[model samples]
Target: MKTPLTSFAGLDLLTSAVIVLDAEGSILFANASAENLLDSSFKSLTHLKLTDLFLNGEELIEVFHQAVAHQFADKRQDLTLERAGREALHVHSIVTALDNPDTPVLIELRENVQQLKLDREERMLDQSKANKELIRNLAHEIKNPLGGIRGAAQLLELELPERHLRELREYTQVIIKEADRLQTLVDRLLAPHRLPHIVGDVNIHEVCERVRSLIVAEFPQGLTIKRDYDLSIPEFRGDKEQLIQTVLNIAHNAAQALHERIRQGDAVLTFKSRVVRQITLAKVRYRLALDLHIIDNGPGIPPEIRNRIFYPLVSGKEGGSGLGLTLAQTFVEQHLGVIECESRPEYTDFRILIPLP
Candidate 1:
């Protein structure tokens, strides 16, 4: 009585959007989101070609052809389509290979490209300004108290008697130690702004390989770091050290989060690289982009706080400072790149998109 599509109807209802298209780019099914966005029913869309949804239908058909060709070779392309009565939506259509080549279907992720562009740029500008303010306040407000506490500790240590000295010394030691700790925190907080960028023509794989070796050396037990790179990518110009630090920080966090699994003896951290064309991030359009992904099998980020993870001082870990990702983002932004995170219970992926030459 129930069909495969019928069985997935519940899932389709739950998703933000889901639509199925045949090999010829004609809609086979459309979910609620698609219906609402398109302002039409499945019956109408099913009878029309996919290109009909876009204003520039003919040009879009060619783009779809190019997308299918790339997918045939196991690659992906960025696609933009503008609807007649609604705003334009950007889509990344992926074609799945099947024994029946003509019946191959394409899964498309449609989103508001213009809004995402504006949001990304606004967030970057706001974050850069906030970081500058944080550094200035940290250097002034936090540093003065820290120095006084450390200085007072030495002065107090001189006035105590031998028997009572240990107790007073311990008290002073606490203040001194806490002050020193804050000093270290302050230094790291201001690091990205203070450090000079070493710009040059550097290969991205070299950066990934360097971080992999460093991580493996520290946690060589059960955690595995794997790489999947596209060799045809050309060398990109950027600050090599900053890139290393940015990647190392994210990779280290993934390794630490995999402690339980690593102790149980099966944890994997994968580094994947590919080339993307006509990609946009932070309001700037790039002809090409270098896509780097850091994937792990450990328990993913908690859903409740995933959206706020990139904010400064927002940490999900018990003893974590939470500045690692903030610093990583700052460094990446300097090189005209953006990093995005997506996670579920079993999988967590950190995607870094950098502009290419």
Candidate 2:
């Protein structure tokens, strides 16, 4: 008899990963969250046994059998899942046996740290808003004083007595130069607030190509910028220049991080794009969205400060202004999007998602 597949339709709406199997452990169905966690489609998942996903599933197999042995029993255990060319995932798995004859066993998998991740994301979003507001206020307070100081320095240099001109010129110049430098920094801090949104048609590929050209020009040798784009992504309304600046800032930072790898002549930075459906951003749900990833093969971001990388003036690199990522984050948020990053020893990936029509 056919498995009760229609009864499992509601499972897709759940954010938890779930799979159904017949009495003999043949797969019957997989849910949406399961498809995403495995990075496979429903059809492909249906063709594979639930045990095949585990790195060490002999125990999981026993759990399946034991659950079936006592039809109404359920068990929970932690399992490490592995897929080819992807990082291993740690998930908490639950196996339950139903009283029904056709579909007896059900496996529910949940990311072991999903709740913690969600909590951290919410906290970080709140912290970021507070940090941005503080920076904007601080920048405004500093801007006017900076101009006054620079003007006074210029006037003093002009009025210095002739006999002391040469000696005092050096001192006056230092004050003037430092004032200008601080002025520039304040302007950058205030840039996002000052600039008006100039929205128009935006082709994501075109933005990628522009960033590619700029990065290629900046790092002429020992660096490769690879492009993997989905041409099917249609144009959407956005601030093209802001988007370009956002991507450029991120690519530029990746290039700077690849200094040693670039010297070794094997640095690879990839720009990959795809259309992701049924995604949510900043508490708003969208049926379709654009997914863009900037991946780099370099020494990864230092974990010590990774959590605060987007905060103003927090930089992993020496002498870095640390505003690049902060500015990029602002730009993406202006488009009602989100930016995220994952880093390990040899790989770093930055993803930006924006809602699409």
Candidate 3:
């Protein structure tokens, strides 16, 4: 006679990770992906409690309890899973109560990094489109009246009577100057949209090197820029100049944020590159992707603006134009990639993932 495990053999063939739990939260079954994800065989996993596998197990356990009590499906995003002697796994988890009272909960987990990236990219693209429309409309509205205002100021300056106009000319000059400044701001806002995306074979290390050289030259005194490159990453098709600027913007921001650390001679910035396999970007899966990280030992991004850092005109730094990250994100997205950030008290990390051909 076949055992109960044979009845659910179909679940083992699924790519997504699945785990079944009894009413007491003990593992009843785990699929193949669950085995690989939890770093344990089905036989071993069955002996463990479901909570034993998650870093935030208590919270998940509560979710299981709630699901059982309410008899409803519950879901959590970006849940961290605990494993022995390994990095925590990030997954999206769904818990559903089983009809059988013996096995009361079913858990489904999927690796969430790529899905999160894809969702973020979609949101960014939508936001970027909206911003472009707003900028175009606002630019036109401001630009039309701006030229008239500047011209009027110039004509007033030219028509001023010499004796009475000396001090008054300064007023006209101020108007022209402020108008010119606003014009420059508008131009910068429109620059990314105006540029042609010129594609070519891109060596990521070369981009990193160029950005490093620029940063070091600017902050030569107390900053150290380190390279942790995986030389195995191959050249891919992209816009070299755009990539250079993207890396430069991130490095430049890190350098600026390291002001105190730079003064203390302890500023450290690292450029790390590796090849990520089987990653998805904007809902498209790629066999390989270039994972580039720019990390810094600085004060980290301010908490208030962390969520909106990628939004246009949002800046953490005083007097920052706030377009650097916006442009960087735009350029990367053009290459079918996404950028993400994680920050805390003493560390800040910016990661850019671009799908490889």
Better of 1 and 3 by TM-score: 3
What are the clashing pairs of model 2?
Answer: none
Q: Which stretches of candidate 3 lie over 4 Å from their true place?
A: 1-115
Error of 3 at 268 (Å): 0.4
- Summed backbone clashes in each candidate are 0, 0, 0
Q: Per-residue CA lDDT of candidate 2, range 1-357, in tens?
A: 665688899999999999998777878899999899888899997888866676667877888888778844888987776666777777898999888777888889898885444455666678779878999889989998988999999999999999999999999999999999999999899899899999999999999999999999989999998999889999999999999999999999999999999999999999999998886577677999999999999889998988888999999899999999989988998898888899988899999999998
Ranking by lDDT: 2, 3, 1
Alpha carbon RMSD to native, model 2: 10.3
Q: Please say which candidate is ahead in lDDT: 2 or 3.
A: 2
Clashing pairs in 1: none
Clashing pairs in 3: none
Per-residue alpha-carbon lDDT of model 3 for 21-84, expressed as tens digits?
A: 8778888889999999888999999999977776557768888998778657566656766666
Residue 39, model 2, lDDT: 86
**What is the lDDT for 313 in model 2?**
94
